[model samples]
Target: MGCQCSKFWVCCWDSEQKGLVVEPPSVENEENSEADDLPAFHEYTIDQLRMATSGFAAENIVSEHGEKAPNVVYKGKLENQRRIAVKRFNKSAWPDARQFLEEARSVGQLRNHRLANLLGCCSEGDERLLVAEFMPNDTLAKHLFHWETQPMKWAMRLRVALYLAQALEYCTSKGRALYHDLNAYRIVFDDDGDPRLSCFGMMKNSRDGKSYSTNLAFTPPEYLRTGRVTPESVMYSFGTLLLDLLSGKHIPPSHALDLIRDRNIQMLTDSCLEGQFSSDDGTELVRLASRCLQYEPRERPNPKSLVAALIPLQKETEVPSHVLMGMPQSGATLPLSPLGEACLRMDLTAIHEILEKLGYKDDEGATTELSFQMWTNQMQETLNSKKKGDVAFRHKDFRAAIECYTQFIDVGTMVSPTVFARRSLCYLMSDMPQEALNDAVQAQVISPIWHIASYLQAVALSALGRENESEVTLKEGSVLEEKKNKTA
Candidate 1:
């Protein structure tokens, strides 16, 4: 019987013989010995995988189908405190041990920033596990399909398209162009809020040399007929992803290509992108998607061409992925100057004495008791405005953030240096350097010793062409930071 799987992908299963079967190596796989020269990967033990996974505890399981599936994924932390996602495959997935190691070694040799890096593999006894860098934030499917708070913005969706293309370009450049079953669930957001394609998806099941994503419907039209995946098939899957991004919903690749040919781009575009992108941008993207979904595999654009096309569509350089995705920055703290940290831990008792002795007045001598009816009423309003500002800030609506923060600051019911710093940042983003500097100075005045305020002042001054003052302010901030660290 002929095996449809290419050697670059994986071995095909001999169901009648009840074992994995291998076809002759392709020209690509014949040269796969190059992986031998690559850096060595850790051959983790079954015991180690068990320990990291808390003996395969139920809570650690991350796979949607649980243990009933042929493969299960678990989230765990290594002894070195590095987090990881472990995929444990069924015994029947790979009947031969060396073939399993060879496949693992080849995949483990792959390294790219856009890839959810494969760290190690365990193939001891009946246990087979693959470990990858853990993504704290969830998958693209969650952000796009089942968005909770807000849908991904147009800029972000465009960025995701570019990022996915770059990832595929990198893999193809590295001679690992056989990335299978590419889809939304295969892309996970990392700790830095960047989307990365999971490398585990690159590993073939060995059962059939087939795509591993549970939803095989995402496969290209040719793959269904040929039962083989090529680089061109991956591009077809990529077109489906483009449709997912544009429409904010899954559309069959066949249907999507028809929509493209009919020039029904408006129906293909998500309503959320109503005013976000120009018609030219939409038309260009639709054209690209159509090219990717060409009926003939040879007609589709390669990964490099896709990358070239997407480079022009990207906007908002240096903006973090999470910001545009409308999700919280993953565990990243606000960038605070040394003074900001000091203010956060400032001795309230000492501050109170310093204020009384140094003639600092609270809200023009209005008592600081929150229980008072007058103060309580003002406090409620202040809290509400600050909350609104935070929501706006998370949404990257900087102009609205400034307005809400300004309202909170104007009330003066509470003394929050952070509020002033936030407004200063919004001002900077809105290209109002003078207002930014004013807010930064006000923040410093409110919390006399905060380093972030001085740092922000340096930024504002530099932006305003006051180089000399900016340098001085920067040095002052450095000194404050040094003092705080020494005190700590």
Candidate 2:
């Protein structure tokens, strides 16, 4: 193993493992070679992660279990427009800093198509976080239990099981055999709609001893007696997962076994999967699940054997997962609104007209009320800077506008969403999308309901090639504008 230690944290990777370590493995990743590859591990600072998640804003949180869960997960986008999922552990969760780093780095070495690979981690002061590939479609629980659109098809369920088994096999091959709390929630669908086992389940939270959150009757018998987890425990959990897929519910292991022994496949099988598979296929799956849930830990099927058993059961093998799940293909770009279209086409003149029409009306109430008695020379300088920025902006001198706007913002004499919006457009015109995004975000912070701020943000995001985010932001702007028009 190759180790890279910094003052904040330690990152290690297996030198022998070949392939570039890209999080959210892409289809084109198959062509990666040993010669042109970067290390699979990164050590991210807490600040970087905070910026990505917008200071851990409430809206960014995506953890299904919600506040009740020990750790919180947030959806974030990196500066490069790469989406990421960041898991922030409770302060006391990882009491041993060294242990947290070791576990994170060890897990970071793994990169597999079947896994939501760990990209990096942050261990600063009392904070401990793990960053991984963001899976857009959400967890198996949502689709399997709380689905709104349609029930998960039989082919997709079989694929999930097979892919999970493959993930376990891959992790075992890499000498990371133990996975904690392997449940439906641990399985998330990626942008391609393919099921991937979450890598976060691989590392045990040192401070949290009660690993299994489910009822003791459902937990592996060995775990109840020993208060420890083993590879067999993971197999037992996998059996529960299979039961979940089969029944579309959280049935206790003993109860499921009884139902299976009574030859009541009808009772155990999901109602929605009635006409999907043959009797033989159902029997084979039940038999596999029974073996996995064997009373004797030694009798459980290993991940390799499990994968072998599941391989033949996979149906519609050639179909893309997105099609099977009835989701848009990863390559499909969402249709943009008029504002988003203008932004994509870089129609600065059109954007300028919109800004001019909107004016600084949104900033009127937000600007600091400075009376003549309290006004200082510093305030005058700030106002002069803003005046200069507006003039340069009107003349299309983006560079000069950015400079003057920076001075005005630095003074911090007053808050103006309009000024920030103008500066954001100036940055976009100057071909600095990231800076433009930051300024636009700041404008929104100053005036939360300002439609112009959201519109500017959409343009900046589009320039950054974050089309999905841009579409959402542009739609938000349109909504705010409509609401304002109605109220007016």
Candidate 3:
């Protein structure tokens, strides 16, 4: 007699002589259809499911059992001694059973390293179930923002970014589906710390006429105005995801739907990662994100280009700024100014006369150690060279000044800001604005808050016809100096 059960199963039994015997379960004769056309799935009755979930015990539930997408996820052991996650889908809204089946089919066909694999599904009578590969690490969103968990490290963040980019490329190219929703919540990590893109319930085929729903914060601005899902739109969402990952903060609950609407991006960044991230790299990322959020869809970069732009950033933890210019050796001094020479050479015999003339002490102790003397000699030489260079500069003898400055620069003596600043000025006087700009930029990089150096840079930049950039440089220099003063 056939077993009175709707579930399909393979029967197994222990024989008296043999250890065990495998046989097919008998079922009532019904009109047969082409089984080859349908996807194969092992069926389980409600009673079998109950046994697997330990009588539907509350403890077996891995996630909350409520009315929502992915309603209930239960970690249970099947009768065959295999562990799996049983996702119970809410059938109240899915009035058409065939639509649910098609969704499952679409998900099953997607095979990607960065994406979660759909194992199988069950659609018998009113009960709907989806079985997927169990991921123990759960979602990226929880780990990133949860108060109890440790924050994601820099390396992990980069890895997540690379994995996400690969997954998006995969979906758009091979699967030919638009992952309309690519958010932190949809990313899950495996035991090995590899990220997997999940939650394709909102995915749509590229060929389908149906459009994706607009979640303004995560949606591209163009799509928000006109509901359409393109590959560029997916890239926009990915960019936002990158921001959230780096920030390590979730969208605020109050304005969750309109999180991306805000123009002041600094407010959206995570306070924890404030000083940890590189300013230059952060600026680049923010710039990319802004482009992604552009109102015109065509203005955004394609996925391939986006990935290419992020390549360099992914390898390095932080972009290094040129902080120190060429360091001259210590004890170096520039040539004495014309005023110094005239006063020293005039040398009045009377102490009173010397004091009145130069306003200086006549009996000041001079450095006498041999090493000190040698250092003084080097300083005198450098000063003489600088004086010669200055004379050349005054006569518009740029080549002579360049040669003198080059030799003085090679002496390994400490060149003060004024000296380098003057050398840069000579370069400017020679109509070599590019070279002058280079020197001034180097000086600024070495000491961004140096007022004289910054001013020189502004002048050089103006000469180069980059007035806007010059203004920005001046503003940055002012800000840097102010910040230093405040800190001091």
Candidate 4:
């Protein structure tokens, strides 16, 4: 009888028949369109869904809704006796309903071995429900920490790692999957103990529209600066997940640096595994994890490379049958000995070699100017430090050399004539004429006898619109050079 729009609900009545008629694109047409484009269900009355979920009883609630984007998930038995996980979208507090709807539709289309399948959806009036295949074993996070479940065997953990990497790779290959808001809580373990990537609520398409909160421990610094989520950023998150799986401890934002600095394998290894897993493999995993957590995203491996690196480890060792058989687990702690450390180093080197052989660096090479800039900056920082500071400032290192020289000036360290002259050359190499003049001025103050510095200073000042000063400096330097040459 009426059609609803943002402004108002409209109904038309025929005076002759005293009947009401509604004229708008039929609901059936709209529903069919939604179904054809993406899987969506006809609106079921809220009463019907409430009944299906046993009146939204607490007992039926499988998991508590998340705080960032809250939604109630209930284990419901439909009238047809099909059991499902009913995710009720919280429309009241959500800022953009249409955007959320678009995200749900896009994520619903992603079907991969590592991804959890979207079953269907229900959009009835103000109530929106997403129906997904129920993950029987709950999330990997819950499985890992739940007292009722056994510790995840090392092999399974590796499988999960590889699975996640492959999923990310698949999403990236499609060129549609932007950044996944990944974390332990989003990884669900099925009855087969295989991990499925879930929680597409935060998923974004290639169009850069989503704004999700950052998990500081798992998110890389680059992602923080630019909203761009590279495969490397996902790899970083996976690496953090690997560490969490090993240690059985929640990695805090504060401890991230310590984990990298200490490289303590024992600190991250899961106590539940009782050190039963191979110490060598554990150490290797930890090292990779640390690499993933590198402050620089470029240092981290891509998801595809990470998958390749982890998959072989599974082949190298036999899965402990007893652990899989559900044996009475024992308590034993594995210590990180020198051998474990060596093995980890070997594994990392092997990964590097494999990556080199694959022409990955050649094909992808620091091809992006941004990547090159980051590399140059890192080189500069290293050269500036006292320990490795003396490395030659080659043409390649000129950017870094200039940066160091500039910093030296800012700190009032240009006391020596030699230092000032060197800094002047560095500034010249960097195309900074004004900076060169300043350096040359300091050099002349220290020792005006430096004819080369004077000449360079004149050139710099000339470039900087100080023609008079430039001429004066050049004449003085020429006279001094002649005098010195005659004396020699």
Best prediction by lDDT: 2
Q: Whole-model Cα lDDT per candidate? A: 0.70, 0.79, 0.54, 0.55
Taking all chains together, the TM-score of candidate 2 against the true structure is 0.79
Q: How close to the true structure is residue 26 of candidate 4, measured as C-alpha lDDT?
A: 16
Q: Residues 48-125, candidate 4, lDDT per residue (tens digit)?
A: 667556566665677776766466787654443344677776665334557656656676666555666565566556
RMSD of 3: 30.1
Ten-residue segment with the worst summed lDDT in candidate 1?
Answer: 7-16
- Candidate 1 has which clashing residue pairs, if any? 339-450, 339-451
Once fitted onto the true fold, the runs of candidate 1 whose alpha carbons sit more than 4 angstroms away are 1-40, 66-69, 212-216, 330-488
- Top candidate on TM-score is 2
lDDT of 3: 0.54
List, residue by residue over 434-468, the lDDT tens digit for candidate 1: 99888877666555445666677777777787776
What is the TM-score of each predicted model, taking all chains together? 0.60, 0.79, 0.48, 0.51
Which one wins by lDDT: 1 or 2? 2
For model 2, what is the error of residue 293's alpha carbon versus the real structure, in angstroms, after optimal superposition?
1.3
